[model samples]
Target: MTTAHDYAHQNQERFQQQLIDLCRIPSVSTDPERKGETLQAAEWVAADMRKIGLNNVQIMPTPLHPVVYGEWLGAGPNAKTVLVYGHYDVQPAVTSDGWDQDPFEPTVKDGVLYCRGSSDDKGQMFAQLKAFEALLANGKPTVNVKFLIEGEEEIGSPNLGKFVAAHRELLMADVCVISDGSVIALDRPSIGYSTRGLMYLEMEVFGAKQDLHSGAFGGIVHNPAQALAEIIAQLHNPDGSVAVPGFYDHVVALSAAEREELAKSAWTDAEWKEATGVPAFWGEKEYLLHERIGARPTLEINGFVSGFYGAGSKTVLPGKALAKISCRLVANQNADQIFGLVRDHILRLAPPTVRVEVRQLASAGPALMDLNSPYMAAASRAYEKGWGQKPVYERGGGTLPILADFQRELNQIPIMLMGFGLQTDGAHGPNEHFVLEMFKRGIDTAICFFDEVGQIK
Candidate 1:
């Protein structure tokens, strides 16, 4: 009898091809033009799930896009069921964003495959399906399996919460395993114990109904552009800390031991500058580079649109200005509280000449897994068994709303964040790619994890 590991290796070529096929679809959730492509991706997922022997596969509809749900509950009553979570949606990408090849076309160079959704999740999610196929084909799986792959993750997973809430009995499981992020290094497989929360908001400032001539009304009236700039400037202090009155009141400070552990991450200022092309390093003066990003909360202006930014000189003071801001919250901090504080601050800083409006776009609380649980230990052993390397425990700066929901609603079930992609994969950025080696490792790890968890009660 062939082992699942051996079966996974034997089918590596086919797995790679299927992943490329999935990545070929431009399932960009935010693009209205790609709605059909998104739905096509969903149907493709359902078909593939059925081909892998999974039953009850369905293309569930949502307000915006569809979610692909499937399961295989052949395990005995004493066995555990693991809910696998991943997203088929991808961030918008184009050639102009600095890609040497077609963003949607899968291109292989050396040992990696490049495409828009290659790493940000299509490939990673594909690995999950292939892993199960290998396990079920090689031998009987000890634990039941279910997949909740969605198409709206890039757009903040707007409708998944309602779906999961309304289908509690249908989606019930003992745990959820997600492979949506990246590891600090390929050699170092990390399991995320915590993730930052998000609070996205939109700010609009209106000066006058119509455009005004800057030459004529330059000094007389306040420019909404200038007003917006001034207001945002007050958001941060000289020391690079959020200046909101209650922003840091509930921030969870990292313990010294925890800080020391995170400092062990494979991050260097040179690598950061080389990747981001930033001239210098800057952040909260008190915290280390890793601490500021990994554990500490942050306030950032994602986008800003004001007066004329066209090609030539147009001396027109636009009637309105708009800005999009986002905040990443840590432990003990609530999104509602942060949104309220930031919105109130923006409104109070506005001048009488401009009318300001703050809209709370979306929000989700942070998640921290209990690393001491039996399931995490099982995950650790699975990694060691699969990759021959001990896994590192880490906290991710990104937010996974579904992880928070699974943790909040399914409080008793454990959630594991065993990401298999590498940091250089460029997940949501230009030239995103996936390492074929990591893809194999992800499948092996998933196989072993199922076997390990099945031993538990």
Candidate 2:
């Protein structure tokens, strides 16, 4: 009989080609023009599952986009069940958006495969699939594995919560693994126990019914863009903390032990500064870098829109202005409450000349997990076995709403986050790529993770 290592080592070239093939599809969920293309990507995932010897593979439809699911239960009920989550969708990308190569076409240069979705998810997602391929190709897996790959994560997962809530029974598992994020480095594999929540919104400020010539209304009326900027400027303080009332009312203070664990991570402030190419670091001044980023709540303006953004100046007093806003909520914070405080603050700051409207585009609560769970330890062991280093525990500063949803839907099961991508993989950006060396190591990690979980059950 073949071993998982033999299958993985022998099939390295095939797995690389498969991932390159997956990256070739431009499954941009945010673009309406690419709806058919996104569905095509879903079909590709489903077909891959079938070819890998999964059963009951199907493209489950959601109101907005489709989810692809497949399962292998050959290990039977005495063993633990593992569920995996990842997105088949990617952020919108095009050559006009500053790409050195076609955004959809996959190319490898110096051992890096460049393409949108290569690292953010497609590459990481492939890690899970290839694990099953290696395991089952050798023998029946020690744990039953189920895959839930969605196509709407890039657009705030507008329909996934409802889908998971509706199919709780069919999706039940002992543990769930998500590979959408990245470790600090190839050697410093990390696992996260908590994920920040999200609240995204759009605020509109209307000054006049129609645009007026600057010469006619220069001094006579207020500028909507300037007013909007003023409101945004007031959101933070000199210390870089949010100035909005009650913004940090629910923030959970970091425990002393947690602070100690955070100090042990392989990342350093110097490495962070070098990677970002920033002059210096700035955030809530009182907390450490990790504590400030993942353990606290944050508010940011995603984008701003106003008049006269064309080739030159149109010389007009803008009739209206708009700003896209988002907030990262901590464990005890509520997304709705944060949105309310922000909306009310905007209303209070608006002058009588302009009408303010804040529309809540999306929201999801933050999630905290028990880092001491046995399976989490099992995952750490797997990382050590595959990557030849002990893994570190960390909290994710970004929001993966589905992680919160899975806990709410299947509270009895533990969730595992084992990321194989690197921080510099350039996910959600132009010329995105994944390190081929890390890809091979990630497959080995997944193989070890499944084996480790079997012992606990």
The local distance difference test score of each candidate is 0.88, 0.89
Question: For model 1, how does the per-residue alpha-carbon lDDT over 1-457 read when each residue is reduced to its tens digit?
Answer: 1388899999899999999888999999999999999999999999999998999999999899998999999997679999999999999999999999999999989999999999889888888888899988977899999999999999988898888887788788998899988766777888888889999999999997888998888887788888999999999999999999999898777777777667776478787788789778878988877678778899999999988888999999889999999999888789999999999999899999999999999898987776668899999898888866888878888887787777766654678988889878998899999998999998998888988889887
lDDT for 433 (candidate 1): 93
Error of 1 at 225 (Å): 5.7
lDDT of 2 by residue, 329-387 (tens): 98888899999998898889888878889999989989877777888899999888886
Superposing every Cα of model 1 onto the true structure, what RMSD results?
3.8
What TM-score would you give candidate 1 relative to the actual structure? 0.83
What C-alpha lDDT, on a 0 to 100 scale, does residue 231 get in candidate 1?
Answer: 98
Candidate 1 residue 49 Cα shift, in angstroms, is: 2.5
**lDDT of model number 1:** 0.88
- Which clashing pairs does model 1 show? none
Location of the lowest summed lDDT over 10 successive residues in candidate 2: 260-269
List residue ranges in candidate 1 displaced over 4 A: 20-37, 89-109, 114-116, 202-233, 273-281, 302-324, 347-356, 426-432
TM-score of each model, in listed order: 0.83, 0.82
